[model samples]
Target: PEDSSRAASVVICMNTDRIRGAPMAEAEPTRTPQVDSRAILEMDRLHVSVDGATIVQDVSFSLRPGERLALVGESGSGKTVTALSIMRLFDAAGMETRGEIRFEGKNVLTMGMPAIRALRGARVGMIFQEPMTALNPLKTIGAQIAEVLVRHEGLGGEALRRRVRELLEQVRLPEPLRVMRAMPHQLSGGQRQRAMIAMAIACNPTLLIADEPTTALDAGLRKTIMDLLVDLQQRLGMSLLLITHDLPVVRRYADRVLVMREGRIVESGRTDEIFARPGDGYTRTLLEARQVDSMVDAVDESAEERLSCRDLGVTVGKRRWIGRDTLTEIIRGIDLSLHAGQTVGVVGESGSGKTTLALALLRLMDGARGEIRLDGMRVDGLPEKRFRRYRRDLQVVFQDPFGALSPRMNIAQIVGEGLDVHEPGLSRGETRERIRAALTEVGLDPSVMSRYPHEFSGGQRQRIAIARALILKPKVLILDEPTSALDAAVQLQVLRLLRDLQQSHGLTYLLITHDLAVVRALAHRVLVMLDGEVIESGSTGTLLEQPTHDYTRQLIDSALMT
Candidate 1:
């Protein structure tokens, strides 16, 4: 068998209708399969390096007409870089690249700018990770989408307008005419994504590469986007290269799975086979991480609250950076309470004022107004002089560990900064002991106390942030999107850790998040906000399961079906 010169993998016959993973259960045996006679794309033993650091080595994968392949891995694992290489999207001058990319059996590495340019946006189309960044800010959605058609196919005038509107309707954006007139900034995150997808598929390219296309979307939006992609793929018979960290999408949609780590394809197999028993350690870890939800501690509603916010409001003078003339009310008047040993979940879409509310609670935002009670003492509107005394009673855990921690400071100093601030008379040795204990509580090795934030993974860096907060032994802990950045399994782990810590220390928590699944898993009571307004408030079971408000129902429906 080894001596035979056949390719090891399945031979993808290039037929537009003969897509990979076609279901045969409902088909008649007499019906012949159709194959598109084209090789959409291929990567051969490619090597890539970033800033002298090798990222991908000898990575090879292929796509035929009407095939679907998923490239999956953790952040910084090179899944994106590989896709960039395929598109010839990355600049070739500074970064080093070696290997062959065969498109229609022609080596792309040997091609000139003219030949490569002819392929991009015409023969090859790409959907970016962040639609907010992908769509143009200055152009209306219709104009922006039309540009792709104009540049690639020379469609103009009334034809282009009609095509653009049709494209919007295909992506299921309501009121296509009205949405077309709006700019990217005016559209919701999901709407902008739909527009971007419309632009990508405008040219009807043979290949479509999607890079983390649903990261910013809620559950409902994610589902809609995924379904749209699947429907488009089937209808157009386009070969799809999906790059994402989302496991559920991969299992439900992908035909083949390509596992990447440190820029190499460590495992490639049928989707079900790879998911059932991953061949590589990295693949197994990635799968395991996705399978689990956020780590969480069971909330004890019976426990008392250590801290709470009563009728909180924060206002700040608006800057002229975005053409705003007057002051902006970020957090509207709101009343919320946190019981000791209980977790309260705050949820909303992007820019829904959730983070603003958290910042207000910490009094971090300038010109704050509200009543923040820590251990029964009013903290809001307290003078800086008086606020310093209560700082130890409340602490916050940030979403990004890399930005939150000081680059120059070691873990010991980062964790002990709270102690040094509140208890200055303590000796250096005492601080070191406290830091070590804090690291242990967060399940990190005490040896890491000397390392900087860069010396950790996303999950580890987040744990360090938690450790820093826990070291303060603050009565109230504000967690802001703590697990959103993590993969599913790592998120599950972190959630469980927070719950355990909350129960063991009898800590009160105010969690702000956009993930409803997480809210369902972690929150006892749920608060829904939109446009600086608290539109829905009730227990998690009541609000999420049977919402009275239309807005709340839409939110819940979007999250569930997406």
Candidate 2:
């Protein structure tokens, strides 16, 4: 590497691509004779760094031919770094890697430029997490795939077109011709993912690198795409290196597992053995991630919610504040507006005022000075007695359902707690009926009303919490990391339920979380907070893809598992 500030232990392995000046294109690789290699891909004592910061350290593993190996960890656990190192792509991002990465008896770290470039697409194909970004916006799907074939296999004209159609068909997409002509955004998420797979496997690479392939898809589509990948891997006789944080996916598909933490390999074993009896503490915690089922009642679509605020600031002290007093301004200068059925996501690191802002808006915290209006009615600074009525119009669903739901209270009492305060004169029979209706509205069995919160799973308890909020027919819900405590599949189920409820009931949402995926899934607008201040705010797509603030960019990049 030429840069003095950033160095890579690259071992000078490269054969110049025409693009050294242009972006390097994967060259037509000289296919070696098929041999029974011990390992399709192998790495030893690998280390990756960027700007003098260590990300991946001493990671070693081997992926056997036709076997599925899962590299498991949360974001920033160095999963992507290791995967990218295998393809030798760190140079593009100004990152450095020092270690031996061998592919089929050849150390890629020692291979020449052309040799490494050939390995990128011709020998080891990569499927990135998001296809919308991976696929060209201006190019047709057919043209993109053809470009790959032309660069590697040198196909032309009718054959190139024919191969593109064949790839679409191979991925089991309906009407190859239609998909071939369609632009990326024109296709659904699942269809776009399938196209990505077609492009990755075009040259029949010996090893396939799938980096968070299904993170963007819904619960059902995740399974379908994985199933397709497994089938293709088997039929094509290719090894798969799956990089993901999903424990359930690893259990369902991966044969071997490599657990990473803080850039180091903490554990490695067969998938069944690791799940059945994990050795590492972090590995066990990941295995113990909650799993639960959910249900909801059908409601007629009716939308009506409006929330806005200005000059809002919440101080951590008594209700009164003075310049000399010991008061701290935790949240300041917040301006927000939400229309009916709108979802605004509040994202930041812990203690960054996300939760404090929610409390200020809900009027749950004291020392909050701001102009707050709900549905065009000023509610700020109202007396306790007067504001109690507005409590029925606003509600909150917390991050941990187990912590929020009262274990001592039965489901009926929990859901009907508000009804008792607001409609104290209602008959017992009427109260019970309303509670039942509320539980049914949130997809919970009304029959379970007699059970306590501890009797339910994580997902069920969250639904109970939602039912508790819905019992009052609130116009707005403050969802504080509502789905973070659930498993990946359960997370999607809850997100889908939230979207449906918002559309049908015309309810508004203020979502607070650190997950960008969740933000993209639910939020129409996003506010990036830092040090109790709003540093950047914009529409979901623009801000996430092209952030203007340095901290906001760092936040997104960290979440991106770089």
Candidate 3:
């Protein structure tokens, strides 16, 4: 192979010799060549429309054999449409597609349903963005992978079972047999993603289209997945169409990039060239978003007294489960404190009891066995009516801004809701003034007050959420993965705004997130949670830089990659 640039080349061979060994290795015969070093997916003047509105206009690109091409764009930017058009999977209702999609030198649009179906999984496979939605819930992970083999290769019985296990093992999943029998609900987020990857690669398709494959994964898991994708592409000799908006992923993984904005290709070039000297303004903006680094650096503002919890115990259900022998305790003996103007970041993976802790602090959960003190006032065991009075002091910014905000309400109404709930009969002028000020503080225009939630972009909507939280003038703000759903640029803006707000308003924050970059940038103190327990907790600088626990070290390493 003369072209080091053409294929996924590795420096050293991996240790695949120890897998089941002996008879298993002997039984597995070498498969036929799958990849062809020729142009696999080519689009020329591709135009698509929905409900008489043009979405993708005159888009042209080509995916060469063994080449990794990335389609970069924001939401509603026709990236998904282009990929769907190639697969002939676009909806017939109010949607129209035209122009040539030459896959293996054949026009896919002209092909019949049966012909396209034949080529779908056998010739090309797709790794969807959200594995949770892409994978079936009731089917076992193994059966899902085996479906591809059965459909395309016609493998059945023992041959199918062996191939399914081999595919799972190839993706580096643990206990392949067990995972095969387990439902999607039984696996973790990362494990589900690996299973999805295994299914995509089961048929050894010539072309693989991965759309935002790492969106739901953590930084460490993301790196592992990308490495796995590269390895699989190399071993299978498949052409990869990588679609994403993440610039760091582009810098580390993609060879060529096609930048899209408003359904148009704004710029197309090599990854290094695009990053170094972005010709388009949109490309530059995308790069700038990715480069939004740490903006929180000042003297320690952690107050000595603000809020505290002691001997905090919490359980969701009344009756003990696990055959009446084991009761699942979400939080047990959890002792924590937050000083005035201090930022405490709680880090953990999904279903690790991070959100449970947050909800308990707000007294949302009933029958919670705990002692929570706010400003020297005990509120944990207080009645709901009395706790509502103390709620003014505590504000929460949820993870999903879209879901948090009311679609029917305008910006001013959303921000003013807190004030209306707490202090009724307030003058409309006063309410407007407060709303405008909060919006201004979050880097949004006051003029957008009349706009509805749907009218604003995602970044703007998130700012509105922050403004809503800030409007309450709460002494302590609980940020539940506030920036997880936002893009890099929007996230930076929000973080910087929060820092400024905290300093100016004298606000203390309890930031709950899984992103270590955010923790390093904004957190003064760190709390690492795993399986409903604090594995490690200390000063942010010391804990992140010199993490003692293995989990903490892993989180730090994941953040530093690329």
Candidate 4:
């Protein structure tokens, strides 16, 4: 495992032996008792290693029947690995696991291949982190869900189709019949996640392992998914093992909380007690980091406008064999302006056209129509050759840093590519100096420039992405969900870095994200979007505190609840 010191200070490691031997004390009377019922799953001194490197070390935890147990930690903390080990999902050739994993009085480690296969869906089901990758894109949603039922229960034909539709309805999916025929890509993020949940619960497994189930979902959708999971678990009388970095969700949904650091349990107790008075410093830091403060400074209204858009719209569709092709408008008529040194946050749920608007503003989308002005120059209608001059002035940091970055390129090549394209006159030595400066600005070591993206952590990769965007010294930077992939502590660090950079360089930012807390932290103004339209816009404090639009109010309430 990578050194724990590389992680955020909020995820400090504690003594592993003490955590393994100690018993959870009684929590405050205000909180629910920690697992008084019968235990359905028990992991005692579990140790997992990959290629002879220890990832999970002497970890121990238990899940009571019908109870919610949360395994909370940052990335590389062995939360996912421990959960995957329960189902023997890791490659046996390269991975080694020791210690006891008991489910219903049966040892899982000694189970044969046939027994493991029978146990996976029928007794223990899992909902992976990324539903898009988990669900087969080529297969219909009904066929995917029915596969589990047919394999485990031997139901086929009409009975299989009927059960699949029933499962979709149980998960509260709309248009069950249509959803049954729809492919994974045809559904929205929340709908795809719901379908994955339906598949996991298709067999009515005694235990369900949800790995960051709501990681990429917006506040409203996240709340809905959490509620659905709780309702289903209660109705079906199954144990829930939730692995996530979201502390608020753990506090609200989990009965018992286990805080992990460097593959060891640092703290374990009732959720309320853990949040109320954490025993470890790491836990306290994690709790404190969740509280975000406003960082918007006083704005100069008379400052020069860095970017402006008029009647911006984007429509996309596919060709059909018969009749005219259907087009769905992604971004509606949007009129907005951003002044130099100001940060404007566009907040919305998935498919709200936030990303579409960002792409349209940057002229990256093919079907975008409308006026896009940068630095008092209209470049929206410019041809590709003519638009090259404006590309350096406008840069974008995408949501997924890993996806946005080239896997084959090293940090120096990735960050310096902008300079090579925009400033061809600059010498190689000059380009290297600029890359080093940008890396230092984003809190990353310049020595790692030779390393590929896979060598760095998620937070580091995001920093590298920022370095790449900043290397151009753009007048307008479009940040799309820049910090959503990080843990709370790392997110706080990134937000602070952005605020500092904005103040130091007078950088203008178009922040597009579903995270209201991030918007609250850095945005001077906020625009609420719903169904491809900007429903509300105002100062961050005014809009978030007293939102007039019902959709905006719903978003805020859901965020606060989580």
Model number with the top TM-score: 4
TM-score of 2: 0.51
In model 1, what is the error at residue 220, expressed in angstroms?
2.6
Clashes of each: 26, 10, 0, 0
- CA lDDT scores, all candidates in order: 0.73, 0.74, 0.75, 0.80
lDDT of 1 by residue, 1-562 (tens): 1111111100111222232222212221111123754566879899988678787899988887777889987766777778877756665445889999998888887888777766663567677755654555678988877766665557789977877787787666777997898887655555676777777656566778887767655665566677767766766677889998778778777888998877778899888899898878888787665443434455566566566676666565555777865565766778887776777888877657787788877877775676777777777767888899787778899755555788799888888888888889989898888889989988899998878885566678889999988887888888887876566656777888887887788788788887887777777788888877788898877888798888888887666543
Scanning candidate 1 in windows of ten residues, the lowest lDDT window is 3-12
Task: Itemize residue pairs with steric clashes in candidate 4.
Answer: none
The superposed Cα distance between candidate 4 and the true structure at residue 503, in angstroms, equals: 1.9
Off by over 4 Å in 2: 1-37, 92-94, 290-507, 510-562
Model 4, stretches more than 4 Å misplaced?
1-38, 49-53, 90-96, 110-114, 132-199, 318-325, 406-413, 416-434, 450-456
lDDT of 4 by residue, 1-562 (tens): 1221111100111111221212222222122344555678989999998788888999988788888889988767888889978877755447888999999878899998778766763577787765665667678988877766665667788877877787777666778997898887666556777787777656556788888877667887777677767765665566889998888888878888999998999999988799998999999988889999998889898999999999999887767899998676778889999999999999998768888798888887868999999999999988989999899889999776666788899999999999888899998899899999999999988999999986666778899999999999899999988987678888898999999999988999999988999999999999999888999999999999999999999999889878
lDDT of 3 at 446: 98
Regions of model 1 farther than 4 Å from truth: 1-37, 46-58, 65-68, 74-81, 84-210, 224-240, 251-255, 261-304, 314-331, 366-368, 401-437, 445-456, 541-550
Displacement of residue 36 (Cα, Å) in model 3 is: 4.3
- What alpha-carbon RMSD in Å does predicted model 3 have with respect to the real structure? 8.2
Record all residue pairs in model 2 with backbone atoms less than 3 Å apart, i.e. clashing: 13-111, 14-112, 14-113, 15-112, 15-113, 15-114, 19-22, 295-443, 296-443, 303-506
Which of the two, 2 or 3, has more TM-score? 3
Q: How close is every model to the real structure, measured as TM-score?
A: 0.67, 0.51, 0.72, 0.83
User: Where does candidate 3 have its weakest 10-residue lDDT segment?
Assistant: 3-12
Model 3: runs farther than 4 Å from truth? Answer: 1-37, 47-57, 73-81, 84-99, 104-207, 235-238, 272-293, 297-304, 313-326, 329-333, 348-352, 364-368, 401-458
- Judge candidate 2 against the unseen true structure and give its global Cα lDDT, from 0 to 1: 0.74
Task: Write model 2 residue lDDT over 400-486, tens digit each, in one string.
Answer: 576577768999999999999988999999999999998887887899988987556567888999988888888899998787545
